[model samples]
Target: MTYPRSLLRAAVLAGMTVVVLVQFAAQLVLMVPGVLLGMVFLLPPPIHAGRVLVSRWRRMFANWTGRTVPVPYEPPPPPPEPDEEGLYRHESTLYKSPRFPAFFHRLDWLMKDPATKRDLSWAFWFPVLGLLPLALAAGPLLLALWTWVWGPPWGLPGEPSSGAWWATAWTALWERPAWLAALSVPGLVALPWTVGAVARWSAWLLAPGVRRPPSAKRVEQTLLAWVRCAMLVACAAAEVVLLAVSLACFGLGFGLGLVFLIPVANSHFRWLANMRRQFAEWGGVRIPRPYTPQLRPELRPDGLYRVKNNLYKTETMATFNANWQWTWNDIASWRDLVWLAADPVVTVALVGAPVAAVVYGGWGLVFPWVWTELFDADWSAWYGAVAGHRTLGLLVGLALVAAGLAVPRPLLVAHAWWTALLLRPTKAAAAEAALRERVERLTQTRTDALDAQAAEVRRIERDLHDGAQARLIAVGLTLGAIERLMDTDPAAARKLVAQARETSATALTELRDLVRGIHPPVLSERGLGDAVRALALDTAAEVNVAGELPGRPPAPVESAAYFAVSELLANATRHGGAERIGIDLRHRDGVLRITVTDDGDGGANPSRGTGLRGIERRLGTFDGTLTIHSPPGGPTVATLELPCALSSPKTSTS
Candidate 1:
């Protein structure tokens, strides 16, 4: 049953081969005219049609083979959207109508997609390669039919056979039964194998992502490295021209006293240097920009702007002068000039030499052999012939190309090192940058801390007004009512007094609860470790407390750490579905460290939860840090560290 089904599927695939051939032909016919006539809109339709056809084939193949083939194309770009001015934007151009922009975008999508090329290649090759399996599947069946119709063993009754070449050949085969059986048996045996082969062939090109073999990946990386080397060489040549322009600008600006050109040259060409700095990452080095912060002119009390000792009525002039001074005084600006001058020389030596060797060796020495051999041209000094020997030139060219391929990656690293030598910030500049970053972080954390404090104050005020203060006012009103009722009705006044007493007790409880929120008494007296143990007793999950501190941390640090741990435990129980949790606290080297580990469904992220972010802000006020490591499964570990000195332990007095 399986054999018959396999043979039938193979036969169906063979029939589908004709459809593939027609589609391939139609694509070529459409593509040539589109290419010649500059009608790009004509190109995408046929390619799109071919993609649809191949996609069906991919689905059929997957179903028969029981192996999935994912779609390889990137998602199509969204339609052009109107900007704030109500004009549609595509690339840099603003369009009044989206029609042309949409058309061009679709054309670019079809042309640039890698799957378009793969689909076209598959269409052309599938029809050609499908022939072998077609024969394996349908050949034996056709032979048997021919024998049944024209030969003696199973000849059709009263049927006249013509003397065509194919008919006579089948007649001869039927007479020799052994020859006929030998031909039919193998194709029948190999039918299932043919189906497997077709499935494998389709998957080879149709699978998504990095399904290509490792050898192909290596070849791709090598080619990309060579291309990068060539690009670096080209950039080197461009830098040489820029260097010459910079020299001219410097000479004219300083020598002729036309000083405006100095800033103009520096500001205009600084982007090229920055681009190289970014590109250095390809060679495994990071070169940060070394320029100092831009300086701004200060506004004076007299409504004039001050740049140095000069005051100007208008801000624009003062700003220009400030920028000029800033650029002029920066040491990095001079380093930029030095790099522009030195880079062309260094790049040409390290990167350009090998690239040029490959280009000249391949095109000059090896490739010209085609002209020499086919066109019978003269082989002389004009075309990289060595001592007029094309053979020797070919060998040397091969050697040079091999040497070029072997050295590009190493030389790229060397060039990056040279770039870093001049482009990276000096030690003093690095320190200044670090200081600036630290100041910015401190400013942000200060804002967060102040905001949190204000919110806490508001919360405390609301609790007092709505809960304790209101309850106390009710108690005072009840006492006044009891005093009024004392003379008229003694029993009613006694009941009122009892009600007032109960109300006062409830108000006192509310006040105590509010005070506990402000500062837990357990944390103040017994310290953080015991406070956490008391917290654990209230939590639903089983909580284990371990480790001990030699002495208590500062009151503020202890409060923040306790709240952080409390939040973690609440999250573990409520959101994490945790069954067990552990808390460890220890002080080492003036740093209070607490780690909370939970056995839960773990994917804890600080960015996703306000509780975690609040904890971070609270800790940041004390220059502490929180680190969370929670993978997808169980066991989330959150570590909190605060740098502070511990005070002496408080003695317990009974």
Candidate 2:
């Protein structure tokens, strides 16, 4: 049988999420075991099993949207380190536990997992959110069907509770043909459109979003942002309503405790925070300058609390009353408060009002007319009273519905632009932020470089300890034994000397391997070209190298490029399943560029692998870059570029 339609997929999913989604909000208490029990024993296993349940929903979303949702779970944190001889003072790696005197780590992945939180949000919102779009699409049809099937009670201005309303509705419809045209025609035609809208809604909320890059056109960006911002605004609206009701209780000389509950209800809700960030990003507003209030840490003994201003803030609160001066010094906070106050107005104007108008005007206008046509005692009298007006109403309603689809985009753009106008930082502020960000990046780059250097040193130490040094020690013992035996036993001495010779050769090989790992001797003597060619020769796949440098790159750049290409070649041969590979290296305009292409099983993601991430971090130290293009199915291309000059004439061989 063919797969079920997309229309039913969400509802089917709603049915399937028995424990995970159906009563998720109600059953959230179950997570206590999943989270708290992680400390006492191996609770992560069950927690991981929950990931299996979440994967089902991901599949459902993918099936509906035709886009694969990448699982967003973070890799497990590193296990505790052990000391010499695979023992520890008090530690345990998740993999090897019994070797150490370790206690259960109190911090559970369950409590901090982003995937789990996303799953929870999806579960809670799917059923509730799906209702709006589905209802919009199907609700009108159902209402029309209800009216056509079960008419209004008794008659116009008549009994609504009457049981015989359906019989009378049919009789009234038969007498008046205009009732069917005006009522049922528009809704039936609009069914496809409403259904599609609802589908997009579901896709946006449930499916992994196809996120747009920052450079996308402002209009398109705002259109998508509107969807996300609308959801956030809706949540904020709920909080507002609750807080209002709470405030009103105090006004009534009742429920005085509600006043105290306001902060508990209002503080640190991330929806508004998220919306603000979205506004700043999509609306093209520069990020606000950060304010650190004190030299001391922001955290308090009790909990996290950010001080709101720079230490010894000097800005005057000109409008501050003497009594309120203490609270009013920071104008940024007050500005944010104003934004909070005006949120409802902006939200309605930008999102809620326009949508309602279109939906109601196009599909909703027919309802009153349907009732009037079906229940009117004198159809001819009412019809004869208004003739062209009925046609006028039809034209207007159709226009409204048509405008509904087109106007929201323009409105969204305008709102974004306005937000940008209000929230955009001054040019001076932006320049400062830019400088600060650059400084931060450079600082991080330096740190990464140091870390890479430290790691390299440790690696070299490890190699010497395991390979060259051990082999040399063995060779020394073998030579010592041979010398001791030479005079005493001549026949046995010859065998000992032969073993010593073999040990010396093995030790020399180990030293060569260690040197190659540090920087290939070919790379130092012959430069990058022969080094890459030599690497290709070692791989099983057919490899070709082209292009020549005017001169060789600096030693560090050459070494980095060789290692990067080596990694790529290894990847292609092992994981990529390549049969053939091409390497093209050239130096142009003081920058050396290396391009590697492989015919292989593709779909390589640099973000997913440690090797690629490490390469990127390594390159970042020298302002180098790696760009990967590997579409699924076959063929992969990786481009590595380094900005540096070459040395004198370089030696090379294949």
In angstroms, give how far residue 524 of model 2 lies from its true place.
2.4
lDDT for each residue of candidate 2 in 91-206, tens digit (9 for 90 to 100) = 22323453323233322345455455665666676665545434544454555555556653243334333335675675555444456445544534454454445445444544
Candidate 1, residue 527: CA error in Å? 3.0
- Which candidate number maximizes lDDT? 1
Q: List TM-scores for all candidates, in order.
A: 0.61, 0.55
The per-prediction tally of clashing pairs is 0, 1
Candidate 1 per-residue lDDT over residues 543-635, each given as its tens digit: 999999888888999999999999999999987899999999889988999999999977676544357777999999999999999755557
Query: RMSD of each candidate?
Result: 12.3, 11.4
Model 2: residues with Cα > 4 Å off, grouped in runs: 1-274, 280-391, 485-491, 544-551, 582-609, 625-654
| Candidate 1 Cα misplacement greater than 4 A, ranges | 1-238, 251-258, 275-288, 351-416, 484-506, 541-548, 572-590, 596-609, 628-637, 649-654
